[model samples]
Target: MKTALENVHDWNFEINYNTVTAVVEFSIHFVSTEQYPLLEYLLTNGTKSLLLLPDDWKLYEEHLSDNEYRYYLGGCIRAFDIDTLIEILSSNFPCIYSRLKKNSIDALLHHDQQAIHGPARLIGEPDRYRFLNCILNAKKQLKSS
Candidate 1:
């Protein structure tokens, strides 16, 4: 995967594994300024999964400046065992499972209620919560498995 990403002239990536914790971190960097939109899209859409926990999206949003575009994207997954980590990485779509923060879990519950009763009225909170929940649950399940 690193080789595949590096093949793109505008893109570079690194994969780091922590042996003691059995965690893998995948980080991608975009070299071309023109690729900022693509970077934003990946961060916004790719991170929207129920099987992966929220990482630094919020921090990124808060700190991003108009003149300074953040060109890096990264995610970490903790595996219950080496075999599980290998299995996740070998699959078409790898993921993680981790417990949701209190606020995030609360938002998810609220979103569920709104979904069953009526449409979510907030502009982007619902989507954010949904994505966060997906990632957290995925991480949690991964750890248990």
Candidate 2:
């Protein structure tokens, strides 16, 4: 099958993660073949998140209203094991973080929540709790400001 993003090249985020993170949305126009069922994204942490796209990037259109984007993000983040995530945080990756530091872990949890909850609320199901609890204890501090 052909991929929706077949010819597309790598993309860049204008904003980098500092105190807050900026998500760079990925898009692929349309596709005929089933080329891209998987999306591989690298996090600020060295961890790599791989998500399975429905059939193509365009498939997102059918379920975009359900916050599938963020959910996919969570699922992708979940793809990497805890060890990998830890390694990523310790590394120099822009999204890299520190589980040891409250702020760092909070940010990671917040990042996952933004991606997962938004979509889970929209789509409904399985991915809802994935890695989300990592920051549950700190929600008040992170969300309130």
Q: Candidate 2, residues 1-145: lDDT per residue as tens digits?
A: 1211223223121111123432212222332122222333333332353222222333432233332221122222232243454343334432411112223444445444433211110111222132233323233334555
True-vs-predicted CA distance for residue 40, candidate 1, Å: 7.4
In TM-score terms, candidate 2 sits at 0.23
TM-score of each: 0.32, 0.23
* Number of backbone collisions per candidate: 11, 13
* Winning candidate number (lDDT): 1
For model 2, where is the 10-residue window of minimal lDDT? 116-125
Q: What are the C-alpha RMSDs, in order, of all predicted structures?
A: 13.6, 16.9
